[model samples]
Target: MSIETSEPTGDTRSRAAIKNALGEQARALGFQTMRITRPDTIQKAGDRLLTFLADGRHGTMEWMEANADRRRDPRQLWSEARSVVMLAMSYAPETDPMEALARPLEGIVSAYAKRADYHDVMKVKLKQLATDLERETGDPVKVFVDTAPLMEKPLAQAAGIGWQGKHTNLVSRDDGSWLFLGAILTATELDPDPPERDHCGRCSRCLDACPTKAFPAPYQLDARRCIAYLTIEHKGHIAEEFRAPIGNRIFGCDDCLAVCPWNKFARSAHETRLHVRAELDNPPLADLLPLDDSAFRARFRGTPVKRTGRDRFVRNCLIAAGNSADRALLPFVAPLLSDPSALVRAMAVWAFRRLADPDAIGTARAEHYGCEQDEAVKKEWDAGTTT
Candidate 1:
């Protein structure tokens, strides 16, 4: 719904009226809450981010380092941006996400990714709100949905939306950790809300719950050890140390988010677009193991997992198969030893050895190792023979 332009009263009262109208419109567009803050509200966030990058904990995500200046402050992102509107949408699972962890044969996708790409879903809503803001204030606005160099979590906290919990994700008292954040940076001035303070005092469930000990301390994440990073972002062979701990998670990790005690308040998403699609709800490892390029694209198109590409996703599935020890998956995995992507082939070797007996490993290695051109896959073949 578009806002009707009206004559401005005093500056404070005009901004207040615009904020109230925007709040109503944001709710109509399926956002859980909307709060306002200034572009300069998060000065300390810049310093904290610098430390994170200097420590090299961001792993291979070099974009964070390159965009550090813009991310440090919203003013640097857009010089004339006078106010930021931080918004939240819920994507909480209807069922316990932990239940999927026990379904070892089924690959576990992070709850948020079981639907279409959130960027596409939320951006449409944000653009509508941006149009309304432009009409009411007669100012240009830019929208973001976890994209670009904007530091959304800090912006959310500054806007009174939530606080950064020990897991370093924004956690709301009302919404728990199930929020997807979006922002509107406008050149118009709006009243700012009081910032939310950290409520994670004495709570370490999110830290201790990590399978790979990705947290070196409360609130600090070592992304290199994070399962989400290993499965989705890290392109090379996953370190052998992390494979078993990765379990059945194919696309991302939800352990830290799921264990937050604040989640007891989280409700299933009110927006159907944020709900898990039926096809992705219980993706069996058996079905996922053999998806070739075209079939993979056809299966995962419009979903976040598709961006990782088939070879990388298949590599994650191979890790799950190796850890599964179901032996039933061996038939599906055997053909991948000759898979064209060296990333997939190397993982196929490791998975083959995990399920195959020594005699079976010797047989498979003799057939594939002789012709294997990739040095990494050759190492995997040799390594599997011993292990």
Candidate 2:
């Protein structure tokens, strides 16, 4: 429905009353915090995004460049959007995420992906909140999760829900770094909450903790060097330089987020659906390597990992297997050397090279290298033989 721009008459509800009621509804809908801000509040976000894109820091994400205008300011997305209601939901892990990194044999899925996909979870709640606001205010509304063009972190900060930290992710003093963000944009006029200030002082714990040094400076990220980007976004072979530092993280990297000192105040996720599943917490790389397309889909059904598809997911597993240095996984990694996808075959060769002794490497090289038509896989074989 189109928005009604005309001012409400004497029968209209008070804006303060609506805001209070919406806050209560938000909490009941599983959101931990909610705040409202003007659509034009994030003026600087566009410039920063342009600079990041101009420097080629966004990597292969061309969509960011395409949607730059709408992402910079919410008003550009919807001219009638007067107020933006930002919400945050916590997904803090019960156990330490860093501990999983030490066990190289197991793939470390990011804490957020260990459970149900937050996009699906948060989208449902956002729709419900938007519906409630429309029922009360008779205003047109639009809701967005992570996939939308809107820059959520800047909007969240503008609404006083959180501040953007040096790690370049939103950080709440109450919920810390583990919070998932969502937004509701409405034509209805509402008082904007006080904006959050930068709480990160001289502490560079997030920057110092990066395995690949993806951050060029505080509050900026270079996506090409980021493990999360390599594993989740970038397709094809992960560069040799990043493979070792990627460790066993198969999905996304949480090194910077995990190291933030502000997370001390964080509480475990209140939503039962967001809790981690036991099987996915620290799955063995060996187990993941055997999953065919069907098995991979069955394993990650309803999770974000499924979006990466079987080839890329197993390719990540192969990288983990290579870094694992576990000889037992050699048997598991061997069969994939003949897999159909060049991406999978290439990664398998990499894993085999890492785990196999000279004799074993020679045997596999002799068997597969002769028939390997893909130039990339051939390079992997040559590299393996030389190494």
Candidate 3:
């Protein structure tokens, strides 16, 4: 079980030098903060993950269940790893994201997804840091962003970056809740930093702020009811119960993160690539609803929203259009009634009913129902007609 130590075991000066150099290098590579931790620092994270999986709180994300072993123990994923370096890059927005919720005509996207994907931006920076660390210490290293099974948050907490807040997201006094985490695991046995202590005392802002009641309790999340999960992850029809509460949010929800008291201390991202594109910030429902598959790909090419695909993204737009009450969006929603995706067509039916009068709904039903083949879309027509 013994691993090679890059720095001499008893050499405090060497350890301090390496740690200081790493912090300097990481900052130079665009990381706002960095900390050192051991591979085995997150035993509690593994236990919590097992409980989360057993409770089926992760929804359709079976990858979490499949990688439980490697995720629980970083050493299991890579036995040769001796120390892990955790890094954070702040993507805090220039304006409050909650403001978008009030504009019913616009589809609110989560702040994180409004910019170029963090996985791509963070990985390039993370690899540079890992390469430098390996060359300097002669240690083998592996880098990861969110794509990996490695528990970056717990490991970040263990490395003193931040504590897991009541919303189960890492919150920093310096950066608030707007940090993207990255990890670099090295086979160098370095000294671990002090773990961060919980600072979220008596605060329920994040929990009370959830639109879908995603947080079952403090420090625990039920992904089944999360808006982010429904819009971005879940592929099927969104349940009837969550649609109205979803409001104008078409991509992902940010209520919990935006309402956090710590965000007052947050700063806007300085990295150009991380800044939200002008077109994506609270764009109109009319603007998004009309996008075809080709247009959708052209519009969201480099962002994470593109990964949600055209059908689901358009379906989300229909939800926004229905809730908007603007009625001007009817023109945009009408064309989608015959959208090739049953998911889109079903939602178009539901949205059309909410925005259209009873006579309009009856006429539209007579015109569109006979040709509809998907049972799900047919159910929407039947429900809308009955109501």
Candidate 4:
């Protein structure tokens, strides 16, 4: 349903008319809401970043600090850009994500990344919207999803799409917290909407629900303690303190987002492609521990899980295997002690300690500790045997 474009009129009524046209286009493009946000001083964006940084919550995401000034103000990214069009697409899933946690032997994927890569899904739509805006206004449009330094959550909140919940994610009344944010910055000067008020009130459900205590306080997250960060972003040895608490979440953690009471209001997504695949939704920890690069790529192609690569992802699976208490999975994790990925080898040793018996451990040590190149894996193996 393409809206017909009219010749540009430099009148207040003309701007108002074009805004409605843009809004209509956004709706037709499957966005929940679209609002023009004035590109002005980003006091709020700066405040959010400053607070998160001062608390040492960003963890290993050094990229967030690299473009601090540009992240705060969108105009720094493009001097001529006047108004930002904030768009949201709902990717809500049907089943309760909490159910996966109870099945300790199965891996739990975060709600968002369980399906097709959102960048692939949303970036195409954003580019189409950009093209449409250019056709209608004869002006340039710059689109951004999660890829840019721009603080999308703050921009979405300011654009009246939603307020940042205690989890520090934009949550809309219509879409709950299951919406993916995208932005299209344009030179067209559309009128801005009033900023949305904080509707979070006394609700601390998101904070209370976190498995790893990622949230230090309302609206602040300590990513160092976040399971999502540990599994996906942090490249080294999984921290000892957070391992067991991570449970079987091998890819990313969604405990906080999953527990939001507002999700009751969320309708299931119409996008069939966003539906969770059976294999990825609850893959067995034993099955995931041994996926070589080719098998991982073949299985996870077009899915967000591929980004972590086979080694990092399998390392996470090893941790989940350690915590599974299945004991049946011990033999499966045993061979990974000689895994080429040092991180995987280290985690395999931990899993052997947790899941393998004295006989199994002795056998693994006798057969492969000689071949173990990683000092860390050897240390864990020696400690596991001695203890």
Tens-place lDDT per residue, model 1, 3-25, is 65364834787878888888988
Clash-forming residue pairs, model 3: none
Please report how far candidate 4 places residue 134 from its true position, in Å. Answer: 1.0
lDDT of 1: 0.90
Q: 165 in model 3: Cα distance from truth in Å?
A: 0.9
lDDT of 3 by residue, 156-177 (tens): 9999999999999999998999
The reply for model 2, stretches above 4 Å from the true place, is: 1-13, 385-387
lDDT (Cα, tens digit) per residue for candidate 2, span 1-387: 212233342233577777877888888888999999999888897799999999999999889999999899888888899899999999998877999988998999998899999999999889988987887787899999988799999999999988999989999899889999999999998888999999999999999999999999999999999999999998878888898899999999888889898899999998988988877888988789999999999989999899999999999999999888789898899999999999999999988988889898898889999999999999999884422
240-297, model 4: which lDDT tens digit per residue? 7788899999998877888888888887776667777777887887678778999999
Question: Between prediction 3 and prediction 4, which has the larger TM-score?
Answer: 3
Q: Per-candidate TM vs. native?
A: 0.98, 0.96, 0.96, 0.95
Residue 255 C-alpha lDDT in model 4: 79
User: Best candidate, lDDT-wise?
Assistant: 1
Instruction: For model 2, give the 10-residue run with minimal summed lDDT.
Output: 1-10
The lDDT values for all models are 0.90, 0.89, 0.89, 0.83
Report lDDT (Cα) of residue 182, candidate 1: 94
The prediction achieving the highest TM-score against the true structure is 1
